[model samples]
Target: MKTHERMPELLAPAGSREKLVTAIHYGADAVYLGGANWSLRAKAGNFDRAGLRDAVTYAHQHGVKVYVTVNIFAHNRDLNGLESYLLFLRDAGADALIVADPGILLLCKETVPDMPLHLSTQANVTNKASVRFWQAQGVSRINLARELGLEELRTIRQAAPGIGLEVFVHGALCISYSGRCLLSSYMTGRNANQGDCAHPCRYSYSLLEEKRPGQYFPVEEDERGTYIFNSRDLCLLFRLPELAAAGIDSVKIEGRMKSVGYVGAAVRLYRAALDYVKERREAGAAWEEIVLPPAFADEIAKVGTRGQTENFFSSAPSSLAMLYDRMREIQPCTPVGIVRGSNPLLLETRNVLEAGDQLEYLGRRLEPETCTVRAMSAADGVPLQRANPGSLILLTVDPPLADGAEVNALFRKQHDRQAE
Candidate 1:
């Protein structure tokens, strides 16, 4: 394999065990995840102690790295619980600990001083001076604030060449700075810093008037409630070459709270893009991004998303309405059938599932897998039986299905489906 500059590490999200596998299988050089505690994503199906051990084992086995998030800003109350947690993470064999608190960093240095640390984006390490300080304090990496631009990132990359620079290459972008927001706690008593963000920014709004005798005006339209603060999904998949060229160590894809299919597709898409870049470099082709076709990316959106966008990159500004519109369906098709069989379980495609259709299974804690349809049933096998919504059918794969793993027998449609 030819090296095109040192290959950028494709860091992806791992919300659960299945997601961890998907991220690795689809193509992630490294993964960042929240533990059951001390992590930013409260809603994700985080790993318990044993689970973390297993996850780390699995990633390391696959020649991938796993980073645990201990990045939550803490208070005096949170400190007492700190030492035990740090010990647990270090014992679990995590690749590194991502932390934001100075006290936490100090404690980590004193306790597990050999444990590698990365400054969280929450640290808002916006300057070379802060980077130097964190490096001196023993932070091995830094996830810079979201507000930084290409120029700022390039400068940091140059200044902190030894320290790994990770960026939010994809996922939701908060309108505020560096995820430090009191909105959820301020409005609903649920602390966002503690992982219970209400996503108040995504909520629609209108002006309420008490003196006007019970009247309301749309905050933006006077009629419709607008998600004025809702921003687009950051899509740097097409800009792989630019980011890689900039000398960033890791291209971090956000979404520890996202679905397995979402995890699988995002990692796979970026992996393909990265490989494409490498291939271009090998062939001496111009290093331009070969993004997955729009329709191809649209398939990813079906997993569930606010629409995707290239946020804050171009500087010229673009309409972000597409991102805010919730009219687009999430999980576009209902999971209507189950795959049943053994001896290398064959997913009896009750419906004509096309190549890229992601198979979702309702497993323990909502864990799902996206197995691309490599081969379907032959004439001797079950056809699209036209069984109703809740039908059970038999099928087979190269390996038999596990005793009880639910798989949503997915089928593609025409145009997209027909081409498949």
Candidate 2:
């Protein structure tokens, strides 16, 4: 792969401090995030002044690159304060700034001329001339719009030989044109232009004619109506060969307001996949067995993903599950007791117990689950609390459970956001 003259980068999103670390540790070649202002995900937990500095330092320590977002459509009022923000980004250690507004791009180049300017996908860069224009204006990269077909990108690459091209390989998609819709403002007076989108497109709607006041018609699916105006999530994990051969520079994932688990799982999977292709080129063959395993990505799917679909790369994907709700939280069962000694496992139970209740620890690693509780014993040498929710339970594990490991005799209600 080294001789293949290709070093495709696996770029991931890092919305929080912990997420950035997770990306680097799990394996992201680079990361992108939004700062306080001028970012598409203004509602996301963007970095404060101190966090950006820390994030840059941590990523570089692990040899990962960082890109900050300056990509929101800016207003005249927004234009006045960007210089200080640019200076802060420059000194705080940003490798590049992804910009959508032409004026913002120009200002970024003029102010932080040393930093690499990446044209945002919002620029709708579908032609060679625009690519060349941005390149001349000092853009080191162009995040091509998702609306373009792969062949269109090939033509753009051939025409603008000098400009580097980046495209989103995975994550959410909008029903609008290249993700630049004004429907939110038109519907709810929430300005998407100023970044307070109401996401009216995601809502299910019914149409009614003026002649028929009470009669309504379903838009797409008649049953309960559909996820109309809802597009599927994009995934290109299996299409690595085509993407690598496409002559693009970086393959980016689009999720900034997502969780750390999501960032780690998806980034690790793609990072492994990217390395798989890289290794194939280096070793001159595919091991097939050694390439990225679906099991890895599956573990991430358990962390609440929209499920994977290969959206519109080679062909359109089937329907995707809706994005996970960040607010609908998953709470852990409170730890009540810990294993104290090694007899029939001398243990202290939080709640009252009989004798035999299936013991469980917060086992996370290994098969069948190490923390998964199965066996049980009693501190009094009598075991019988076989079925219970809260009890000072002593459950024996296949492999002796850790002494300090948390034991659960209680079951808490778990709900999937969409399922609920």
Candidate 3:
């Protein structure tokens, strides 16, 4: 690696033990996961106590660090067992605790003094002063808010060069400042800050003025009203050099609730991008020559997403950052199968897989490989023309694969399948 090409750690989301393993196996340097409690992603398949221990052990065995989230804004009742939870995480050998609440931070300091603390993005850290203050309170790292621009980030880095700073280089972007929003709670009675976001921001709404009780008008003058608060998904794979130049210590990829395939593909894509930048820097090439590979964008698109946008990274974000017309992810395919065996490759189907259907196999630390399904048979050796969901079938593959490879269908953009 070149002297100036120190690659910031690529931190991926590990929502469960499976995700944790997938992230590490796919080349994530570190992973951040939420516990069953005190996490912002309540809908995610979060790890419990036993699962947390197993996850930590798995990541450590793979030479990856684990950061557990204790970042929820707590009410009086929520703080009851927080101290014990903190100690449990410490004993579980968690590398760090991602926290947002000052009270939680204080409690962590009082309870587990040796536990490393990472300030979560929910803390809305937007300046060096806040960074220094947190550092004084024993925060070793700060995940900066998404509302900051590159220029603001550069200034913060210049002011506090010694303090470690992380930024969200990819994944979902919150419309509110640092994700402090009342829309979810106000609309659905679920507090977003407490890990139960209803995602009211993604819902379409119309205008209902006073004295217009029976009338509804489109907010954006369209027939379908508008998804006013829907923010576009963030993508910064092409801007790794700028982030490194801005002195970012780590680059985080969000989406703990996403699929295992998403986690695997994303980790590989960002890992490749980081390696590409480091290789170019080591070659002593001009920064102008560093261009993001077109394939990188295509690979990212393979996973379901609403759309991509820079989202305040370049300049003041306008209407361009929000996707008004669509709300759900536009996935191009259905996850048909997952590899259960390497030798004489076996597949466990999530969706129906038919003979002669072209499939894409996604694996850890490797690019996706496309192959045609020539023949299929049940695990019992019965010849089959099609394998339904929950059926395990053996595939005749030209190149044998290692265990745990994921197989997905290559459906077109207009083709949409119900969630399996």
If scored against the real structure, what TM-score would every candidate get? 0.79, 0.74, 0.92
The sequence of per-residue lDDT tens digits that candidate 1 reaches over residues 252-312 is 8888887555676567667776776777767665545434346435445554367667665
| lDDT (Cα atoms) of all candidates against the true structure | 0.69, 0.68, 0.82
Q: Which model is ahead, 1 or 2, in terms of lDDT?
A: 1
Position 182, candidate 1: lDDT: 90
List the candidates ranked by lDDT, beginning with the highest. Answer: 3, 1, 2
- Which ranges in model 1 have alpha carbons more than 4 Å from their true place? 1-4, 222-224, 286-304, 316-420
TM-score of 2: 0.74
Per TM-score, the best of the predicted structures is: 3
How do the candidates rank by TM-score, highest first? 3, 1, 2
Q: Which ten residues in a row are the worst by lDDT in model 2?
A: 407-416
Model 2 backbone overlap count:
17
The 10 consecutive residues of candidate 3 with the worst lDDT sum are: 407-416
**Candidate with best lDDT:** 3
User: What lDDT would candidate 1 get against the real structure?
Assistant: 0.69
Per-residue lDDT of 238-322 in model 3, one digit per residue for the tens?
8898887667899999989887767766787888888888788788766667887777777777654777888878898888778
Instruction: Please tell me which model should have the higher TM-score, number 2 or number 3.
Output: 3
